[model samples]
Target chain A: MRNIKLIIEYDGTRYFGWQKQPELRTIQEEIENAIKKITKEDVKLIGSGRTDRGVHARGQVANFHTNSRIPADKFKFALNSVLPFDISIKESTQVDESFHARYSAKGKQYRYLVYNSKTRSPLLRDYSYHVPYTLDLYKIREGAKFFIGTYDFRAFMSSKSCVEDTIRTIYNLEIIENGDLIELKVKGNGFLYNMVRIIVGTLIEVGCGKKKIQDIPKIIESKDRNEAGHTAQPQGLYLDKVFY
Target chain B: MRNIKLIIEYDGTRYFGWQKQPELRTIQEEIENAIKKITKEDVKLIGSGRTDRGVHARGQVANFHTNSRIPADKFKFALNSVLPFDISIKESTQVDESFHARYSAKGKQYRYLVYNSKTRSPLLRDYSYHVPYTLDLYKIREGAKFFIGTYDFRAFMSSKSCVEDTIRTIYNLEIIENGDLIELKVKGNGFLYNMVRIIVGTLIEVGCGKKKIQDIPKIIESKDRNEAGHTAQPQGLYLDKVFY
Candidate 1:
């Protein structure tokens, strides 16, 4: 059997998410069905992580085992020919037997777009969160510094998630502003469910003077779900890259 | 009656062009319906120009005369409250009584996006033209210069157009290359039907070695539509700005 690694990109506007459900359309199920059509075998695809519905991905990584004689690089062309226009295979290569898509991943990077303008932009409606109020970037930047180190990020996660190991390390967080668009790029070793969105939501509160710049540490230390701000919309989030 | 001017933006993916047809969904018709809902008057809207199906606009200008008592700037907020998410009124103001959207325009600027890569991008599928061939930027730049002056651009237009005065003045043409995306920004006093698309297609042929760099002037002098390359797809074209 060959262990095939794939890098994929997708527009998640119409998808339920990266995971497969019985009746809903998903990215993983579509690719797995395509693989079955090409290889004539049932293969379980392991994704690096899960993205909520309407969340996009630029470099999602996945791996699956197959008993086919097709060349690794040619799988991209074959898969892309069958996949829908909203999904594309960027690369496909063979890996060693021990390679695992989820376990072997070291870190991940996420990008969020915020459209901070008085008037909503039709072109950016599907890909960005529209915030029609004045924001204090200085306050937002100051508050973001608290999320750069290792800590218990239980408050930043969704209350529905019950993962026991809530300690994670964040390497870097950057806030970039261009015209009416504010972009947030974050890199971390691992993330809890809804972690990045909650962080962005907290920063937005700080920017709008709803929360104090000095309160981020307290919110993280509390480890209480109610201590954090609301979760940002899923459409503005993108799974940018996964490190192996 | 008050003459009102509006600067609008739209994501034209679902629209059947800017003009109104009896049974088709168009930007003009949608805006006209929204206007009637607010002012309860049947008024005619004059657009700066017509954008073909699937083409977008960032700063399309239009004007109309109305007997409503709504303030000029307040119309933007009122119209946006009732309009669909795919169209937006960026600005609205009262203009001089003699102002006409189509007749008073002096020049226009357009932008085109070309995605040049081995793999198709799912994120840019609706807004960019995908070209899987390697292009030489130097050759494209050289070929674009021939279009920077006044000329009879009959060959660059669609064969169905019957405009007698085929002469137009091009102020500037720029080709910007960034990674796998090539951007073309052109400003001109006027353009014939399908002129920009044909020009882009011809320049692409030159970049890919399908057409020679030295044959641009002769192609223009021929004044034959077949002498030029194919018309580029409408999805990659954007009406960027309108000058008055």
Candidate 2:
């Protein structure tokens, strides 16, 4: 048996999410079906993580075990020919039997894009969150600094998340401005469900002067979901990179 | 009655071009419907040009005669509230009674985006044309210079175009590279049907060594459609600006 690792990219606008659902279109289902067509094997494809509906990904990782003898590098070309235009296999390679896509990940990077303008932009409607109000970058930066380092991000997680331990280490977090677009880049060992979106919502509140910069520490210490800001919309979020 | 001018932006992926067609979803039809909803008047919307299906626009110009008492500047917000998310009115103002969107235009700038990568990008599927081979930027620049100045560009026009006079003055043409994307910007007093797409197609041929750089002038002089390259796809074309 050969273990194959795949680097995937997808525009998740029309997809239900990364995971497969009965009689619903999904990123994983499309990829798995494509693999089935290529290898003629019913193999289980595992993703590094689950991104919510409407979330995009530039470098999502996945792996599967198959008995097909096709060359590893050629799988990318083969899969792309069969996959939908919105989902593409960027790269494919053979890995050891011990390799696991979800467990072996070292870190991941995510980017949330926001379009700050009085009027919404048609070109960026699906890719960015439109904020009509002017955002204070200084306050946003101050709020971003609070998310760095290791901490229990329970307050930032969604109530629907079933994960018991919410401890995670954030390696870096920064905000970048490009014209009218604002980008929030976060890299961490792992993320809880809806944690990144909640953090972004809280930071936006600080940027807009709705919340004080000093309130972030208290929100984190509270460990209650209600203490944090509302969860941001998923359209602006992108799973940028997955490292192993 | 007041002639209201609108600066429009739209993602043309889902529309049937700029012109109104029977039972077809079009940019003009959408705008006219939105205007009817706001003013309760059936008005004809004149667009600066007829962009082919799947061609985007960032600064497309249009005008309509209306008897509504809404302020000109406030028309933007009022119209955008009723328009679909894919189309937006960026600016609105009252123009001179004699001004017409199609006839009074002085110059127009169009941009063609090409993704020069070995693999197609999922995010740019509808926004850019994907060329797998490496394009020679220097050759593209050299070929771009031939399109400048006054020229009778009958050879660059599509056979289906009904325009009698093919003479047009190209003010400027330049090629810009940003990472994996190549932008071909062309500004001209006016353009014939499919003229920009044909020019881009010829330039790509020159960049890929399919055609020699010295053959450009001869092709232009031929004034025969068969002498020029094929028309590029409409997805990469964007009506960038209109200078009155």
Candidate 3:
């Protein structure tokens, strides 16, 4: 069997999520069905991680083992032809048999978009979180710095998540402000469930004068989910890239 | 009675068009209905021009006459509270009764987006027209310059249009290339039906080696609709602004 890797991009607006459910529409099932149509095999495709409903992805990585003789590069075209317009195979390649989409991933990059304006944007409704309040950029920037470096990120994760290892190293976190759009680009070795959204929410709190910039360190030290700010909306979050 | 002016923005994906038709959902009708709900009066909303289905707008202009006691600026907030998520009244103010949305408009600016890439972009699916083939930007830029002048643009119009005067002045036609996206921004005193789309299509043909760059003047001089290229898709078109 040959191990094939695929890079995917999806709108996620119409999808339940990346994970496969019995009766729900999902990105995983759609691609798996498309793969079945092309290869006639019941392949279990492994994604780098699961994104919640309405969460988009630009470089979601996945892999599957197949016995088919189709060329590695050809899988992208073939799969894309049968997949829905909301999901697309960006690149496909044959990798070593030992390679796994989830296990072999070294790190991930995510971006969260905040539309800070007085009025709602019809064009950006599905792609950004609207914060109809003026945000202090200087405060948000200062607060974001505390999230970087190795720390127990349990406070930033969702309470529903039961992962034993909550300690994650954030490599970098950058805030880019362009007009009404505030983009948070984060790179981390691993993130707990809802970690990025929580971090974004915390930073937004600091920007809105709800939380102080100096409070981020204490929030992280608490290692309690309640100590952090609310989890931001799923629509604003995007899985940017999965590093191998 | 007060003559109120409105600057509107809409996604336009779910709207039939800007015009009101029986049993069909339109941007004009939606706003009119919202106005009726607020003032309990049937008001006719006059738009600068009609945008086709799926064609978006960043700054569309409109006006309506009303006898309601609501403040001009407060109408934006009041109507927005009852309007759908896909439509927004950006700004509203009292204007002179002599001002008309369509007749008083001096010029308009439009933008067309072409996503030049091999694979389709799911995120940009509703926003841009995807051109799979690689286009020669230099040729496109050279061909676009010919459109920046007064001319009888009959050949660039749709056959369904029955306008007597086909002459119009193009103030500027700019081609902005950024990564895999090509944006064509055009300002004109007036445009015939499908003029901007045809111009974009013709320029794209020139970029793809289908039409010659020097042949633009001849195509314009032909004054025949058949002499022009195909009309581009509505999704890629945006009514950027209406100047009075």
Candidate 4:
């Protein structure tokens, strides 16, 4: 028996999510099936995290156990060929028996894309939130600065979330602009479900003059979801990287 | 009747192409239908150029005649509300009676996106071409430099294209990189049918060391299309902007 770790990428548009659910198309189930077909053994793949429908990933980590003639490094190419075009294996390596994709991760990074223009771009429809207003970029930058550090992010989490701890440490956050595209990059030791989306929505409000950049600290202290910004559209968020 | 010029954006994935075709869904037909819904008038939009099926557009130009009560500046907002999210009007302005979308355009810009990495990105399945091999950037740049002048691009067009004059000025051609994303941005007065894709395909070959950079000028000088590289996949090419 051997364990394999994979660097994964996926377009979550047509998927139910990362986890397997009955009668639903999922990233996890697909990867498992691909491995089963190759190894003739049912293998359970452990993913770094779950992403909601219509979200995306650039570098998601996953691991599985298998007993097959195929080498670990060769799994990337084999699985990629069998996987759907929207899901791919970037890299695969042999791992210890105790290695777990989700449990062994030290931190994660996410990016939310916003297209700030007077009109929406069809080219970016599935990948970005369109805001047809003048954005105060400086205020948004200041707001991003406020998010860095340890905080109880209960105010930013969705009520539907089932995580145990409300406390998380955001290591870094930055808003970068490239033409009309603005990306909100955030890294943290842990995230509350929908925390990134809520942060993006609140920061956008700050950019649009509906909220103050300095108000984020107060909202975090309040520990009430209503005190934070609205949850942003899911299509704009991406799991950029999962660090181990 | 007032003539309105529009900066249009479209997801050409579902449409037959940019032009009107009775046999299939078209970008022109969809926009016309949206206009008829609001104005109760059948209208045909003339686009700056035709794009192939499964292609995309970021800043396509088009024009139509309307005597509707909606203001010209408000046309984009009004039309966007009714149009599919994948097809949108980015901007609109009342144009002179003599202005035509196709004829008045002085130049056009197109971009071909390539995801250069060891693994394919699932999110970019339809948005870019995935090349897993490491690319030699300097070699690709050298080949790209050959395309930056007025020249007859007869060798670069596909046989299916029907254009009498192949002489076009390539004002600028550049390859830009950001992380794993690489964009081949080219602005020119005009392009031969499949010219951009052919150039991009050739550049990729050069980047991968499949072809020599010095051979590009020789291929361009040849009048036969067979002398050029194969046309790159259509999905990665975008009609980025049209200048009037």
Candidate 5:
């Protein structure tokens, strides 16, 4: 048996997510259907993690075992023909029998885009969130420094999260300004449920002058969900990449 | 009454089209709904032209009359609040009473994007057409020469189009290659129904080396629908800009 790994990309606007649930159109189900049609195997694909509905991914990874004769890299070309235009397998490679897509992941990177302007953008509306208010870029940068170390982020975890460990190492957190768009990029060893989003929301509050740059430390120290800023909307967040 | 002109942009994937059709979600209908909510007016906002379903726009223009107390430019913010996320008024200004969105335009630009790769792109699936084969770029340039100058493009018009005069001037026809993407940008005084799409189809045929490049003049002179290429899909086309 050979394990195949896939680097996938998708527009999550029309999908339920990466899991297969009855009555819900998910990326996983669509990919599985395509695979079944090509190989006639009812193989289950395991994804790196669960991305919420309407959250896009550029480099989502998945793996499944198959006894098919086709080359691993050729799966990208074969699967794309059967799948809808919204989902695509960008790259494929054969893996060792011991490799697991989920368990082998060392870290994950996420990016949240904010389209800051006096008016919302038309072409980018579906993909990014529109915030028409002025954001203080310097203040937001100062607040980002607080989230760059290992901490118990219990305050940022959501009630719906099943994560047992609230402590995680944040390798990097950056707020970059590019023309009219502001991108918040965060890389962590592991994230609590909604942790990245809550961090972004808190930073946004600081950007909007609602909170001082020093408030992020206090919010993290409190370990209360209410102490954090706000849970940022899901539409702006994207799972950029998962490192194995 | 103040006549306000708008430079608009939208991702038309969710819209029926630019015009308001009964029981269908149209761009015009959404903008009109937002206008009615703000000014209590049931005015028709006239667009420069109709874009078929799944078409996008960057600088499509529209004009409407209103007696609202808000300034013209501020309408961008006001209307965007109630309008769908995919539609945006990029720029708004008060125009002379004699100005009209459709009639005042001297020329308009349209662009169609194609991804020429063996593996389809997951990020731009909805935004571009995938042609997973190698094509000769020089041949396409020869065929596009026939589209320059002027022609009565009756053969290229769709059967569904309702128009009498098929004569239109083609100001410029350009085929540009950018990375993995090929962009077909055409500027014309006007276009007949599906004229740009048909031209694109013919150019793609030329690019694929299926049709001889120098045979373009005969194809146009033939004025037979069967002589031209297939109608390109609407999803890859966009109204790039409108010239006043």
Candidate 6:
């Protein structure tokens, strides 16, 4: 059996998420169905992680074992031809039999976009969170510094997350401003459920002066979900890259 | 009676067009219904111009005569509350009774976005035209310069256009490249039907070496629709601004 790795990109606006649900449409289900048509095998596709509904991806990684003789790279073109316009395979390659999409990943990067303007943008409605308030970039940058480094990020995760380990190392976090858009980029060893969105929400509070920049450390130390700000909407979050 | 002018924005993905067609969902129909709900008046909504199906708008202007006592500016907020999420009123103000939406416009600006890359981007799928071939930016820039100035644009318009006068003055036409995206911005006193799309198509041909830069003048002089390149798709065209 050959382990094939695929780099996927999808607009998650109309999807339930990255995982397969019983009845609802999902990114994983669509790709798997496309594979079945191409390889004539009921392959089990394993994604690096799950992205929530309305969350987009640019470099999401997935792996599947198949016995077909199709060249690895050709899978990108073949699958894209059958897949819906919203989902596409950016790249594909053959990997060692032991390689796993999720377990072998060393780190991941995520980006959350916010349209900070008095008026909402029709072009960006699906891709960005529109905040019709002036955000203080200086305060946002100050708060972002606290997220870097290894720590127990229990406070940033959703309460519904079933994962036992709450500890994670954030390698980098930065805020980039372009015109009326604010982008929050974060790289971490691994993220807890809803961790990125919650972090963005907290930072937005800091940017708007609702929360002090110095309070971020205390919030992280508290390790309580309630202590953090509201979870930002899923539409603004994107899986930017997966490092292996 | 007051003539209320509105600056509008919309994602045209799900809309048929800017015009109100019986039994068809359109931007004008939606706004007219919203107006009826707000003021209980069967008012006629006139747009600055008709944008084809799947064409977006950032600053599309429209006007309507109403006798309601509701403040002019408040119409923006009122209409937005009832309009679909894809449509938004950016600004609203009272104009003179003689101000007509279509006839009184002095100029218009349209922008066409092309994603020039080997791989298509899911994020820009709705807004940009994907062209995988390598294009010569220099050739496109050269071709654009020929389009600046007054000319009879019959060759660049759709054959279906019924207007007798095809002469229009192009104030500026520029090609801007940012990363993998190419922006074609054109400002003109008036445009023939499908004029901008056809111009973009011809320029794309020029960039790809399919058509020479010197052929543009002949295409314009021919005054035949068949003389120009194919009309580019509607999704990439945006009504950027409408001048009074």
Give chain A TM for each model in order.
0.99, 0.99, 0.99, 0.97, 0.97, 0.99
- After TM-score superposition, what is the CA distance of residue B163 in candidate 3 from its true location, in Å? 1.5
For candidate 4, the lDDT comes to 0.90
| Candidate 4 per-residue lDDT over residues A108-128, each given as its tens digit | 999999999888888888888
Order of the predicted models by DockQ, top scorer first: 1, 3, 4, 2, 5, 6
- Pull out the clashing pairs in model 6: none
How close to the true structure is residue B36 of candidate 2, measured as C-alpha lDDT?
94
Report clash pairs, candidate 3: none
Scored by lDDT, model 1 comes in at: 0.94
Candidate 2 segments whose C-alpha is farther than 4 A from its true place: none
- By TM-score, is 5 or 6 better? 6
Root-mean-square deviation per candidate: 1.4, 2.0, 1.4, 1.5, 4.3, 1.8
Could you tell me every candidate's TM-score relative to the true structure?
A: 0.97, 0.94, 0.97, 0.97, 0.79, 0.95
Model 4 over residues B1-244: C-alpha lDDT tens digits?
9999988888888888888888899888889988888889888789999999988998899999988979999888888988987898989899999999889889999999988988777888788888889999899888999999988899998899889999999999989998888899999998888999999999999999888999899998888888777788888989999988
Shift of residue B167 alpha carbon in model 5, Å:
8.2
Residue B233 lDDT in model 1? 90
Residues A13-49, model 1: lDDT tens digits: 9999999999999999999999988888899999999
Listed per model in order, the count of residue pairs whose N, CA or C atoms clash below 3 Å is 0, 0, 0, 0, 0, 0
| lDDT of residue B237 for candidate 3 | 93
Segments in model 1 whose C-alpha atoms lie over 4 Å from true places? none
Give the local distance difference test score of model 5: 0.89
Q: DockQ numbers for every candidate? A: 0.81, 0.70, 0.80, 0.79, 0.56, 0.55
Of candidates 6 and 2, the better by TM-score: 6
Lowest summed lDDT over 10 consecutive residues: which window, candidate 2 chain B?
B115-124
Alpha-carbon lDDT, every model: 0.94, 0.94, 0.94, 0.90, 0.89, 0.94
Q: Give candidate 3 regions above 4 Å deviation.
A: none
